[model samples]
Target chain A: MPSLIWFNEDSLNPEHQMVKDYADAPKVYVFDAPYLQAQNIAKHRIQFIYEALLEIPSIQIYKGETVAVLLQLIKDLAISEVVTTETPNHMIKGWQNELQKSIDLVTYPEIFPVTDHSSPRRFSRYWRKHERSWLTV
Target chain B: MMQQLRTDLELADREAIATYLQSEFPFVEDSGELSPHVGGRTAGLVRLQSFRLEKYGKQRNFLDGEVSQLSPYVSRGCLELEELRQWALKQSRSKSVEAFVSELAWRAFFHLVYEEEGDRILKDMEKPKVPMNQHQRSLPEDIAAGTTGIPSMDTLIHMLKETGYLHNHARMYLASYVVHFRKVSWRAGADWMYSLLIDGDFASNHLSWQWVASTFSTKPYIFNRENLERYAGSLLPGDPKQGDPFNYSYEELAERLFEGAYMPEPSGRSPGQYQ
Candidate 1:
């Protein structure tokens, strides 16, 4: 259940269907930070996301900025648990450990042909055995 | 919670189990005590980034072990994909960089499918078709030992076994050989790979296998022996014969590349040699 998953306000159409689809949705928050006509901070015991953009001379610096923002998101969300897939990379792993002492975290297998998070192995097995074309949603 | 998802899946689904260990226990030097329940380390995201930016596309096929060997790290949850993406986006503006970034995306794409459809993604047919080759096939120990009489492939397989890492280019070639030339199922190849590769990830390993099997591709893949010979440069920075090679040279490669100190050799032979 997401109270607020980061959405690019300046980029995402305000009239986009997902926004209206959950217009009446509760525990949902939106951060159109770049075009904030008003403050978007919420007072919650668990998580509080603060959105900001930084000026960086290099793309690497910008990526560091993104990580910084993510760190902030984790702090704001009071995210006791983090979930993601394992790839041949490790920054998320590093951050997860940094946060593990403070919370529970797990990586949902993201490589499954289906997104259910339930049948990754079976789905992989089936595809490997049967030559199935996975549907993309 | 992840186990609950597994309970909802099937008994033999090892990939799900692998993913759970990766995401939850990701590799920390102090990752508590090792146990049957836990897989190994996942940390190596930054190192992987350095590998791609510095060498992957340019030299991955040529050199055998120069890449970061990040699979084990990622597989064990010592690394995370999103963080790698964020790091990559920040550092690179080139399409080559983007290509490396998309490779990671490819991993996500397969996972996304599994997340969406569950058991359906694993099916042989989109709608169900007659099984192509339900009977399993086994490779001889010699072939399995990378002595198939094909130098490039043998080198590729040899590297995979000895180092638990194969260059991405070599990975594709070896996979294609097993699927098309040897007439092996991609799953069988995947199983073999999973057993040997320390970094074997279901998404990258399986999906890449499918791509090689031509099940996921619009075009068939075939890697002739010549292609392998031409690209058969070592991937490691130093010789494997050096002492404690895996442990010793990785940091050197990382340092040389990250500091932009020196340009490493390109894959396989020198330009004149290949020509």
Candidate 2:
């Protein structure tokens, strides 16, 4: 089953370590109209996204509902699964739920290491506990 | 089908894309020369490779410091905090790297707060230790127009509006001045700054404003003339001894600026103490 890599603003790097296995996979980057409207992202930030997309190879840019666009692409390309990098956004989580019903949706871990312990509300407390692990190498 | 749609855009460069977006979305401001540098995975990687951590640590607080202009990449997720940390660790064993690493930790901490609290981070993280006057909700017109008599702040506003970037120290100073001196709500100041910053992350921008406003921290972060002279003297226009309003001692600054809402009471322990 050929997979399609979906690139969002948070994970635009095509050469990300997680995507190495799917190096030859066709990638799609969507403008995510709903997300943009919700976020109220500035023009400069949007420009940054456009410039980044220009760097990656064979990435199709779409401006619409994410799930609808992905579903149509899956049908058109016969894509068995959609792989994307995980973001902390709640909207992405909702999109993933809708997406999983029709096709396989695989999310790679964040670029940073996730801590096992619950993060403290204060930065000092968080840093005191995680600094050693973070700085160890 | 998707391929055909992309083929139409395949020939488009950044300028064409910007033009198309601007025409389609009227809210999108024309960035002009203040347009942020082109960011891609390859460019971000190259920037990371060339960053000088030692110089960054030594002078990052100064206006003309050797700051790594990598925040746009970091905020956009082109570069990761963990990746930068690993690079710093490999490059040096000096304490300078500790300063740089701690800064990275701050970014990570902000993200952690945002992750755990969600939209709650938009409000005060904790009840402010001091009494706070509920201030205006909107950014002042003068501040927005970059005509705020204060030299350093006016320069920062111009820079932020034009470049979509301001040095972190300059950000802190501007944020502190807006929230504390102007008595504006941190939210207003945060929103204004967030709108222009190319590297704006809600977690960092909002929480940092809260920190400066004393909503997120024990004491408000304040800067005086002497402090500005030490860090941003080179960037300030004209003589400090002339008609500059910022040219005042810490005690005078505290008395004049805070108006008894907050004051720097001298303690026997330290030469310069704020209470």
Per-model lDDT = 0.41, 0.73
Candidate topping TM-score: 2
What does the lDDT read for residue B116 in candidate 1?
51
Per-residue lDDT tens digits of candidate 1, residues A1-137?
A: 33222222111122223334444322112222221212111111001011111110010111122234545555766644443333222323444356456545443332333243443333335444322223211
Q: Tens digit of lDDT per residue, candidate 2, span B164-191?
A: 7888888988887887678788888997
What tens-digit string does per-residue lDDT give for candidate 1 at B1-275?
A: 01111123222343443344344323211122222221222114335545756555565446543455554444433445545556656764664455445555555656555445443333331311112263246654655777776555676676666555665666776775676556566677776775455455445666667665545543234433344445654332222343321122323432432233222243422121100
> Which candidate number would show the highest lDDT if scored against the true structure?
2
Poorest stretch of ten by lDDT in candidate 2 chain A: A109-118
- Residue pairs with backbone overlap in model 2: none
Against the true structure, what is every candidate's RMSD? 18.6, 3.9
Q: Which stretches of candidate 1 lie over 4 Å from their true place?
A: A1-137, B1-57, B64-68, B117-136, B233-275
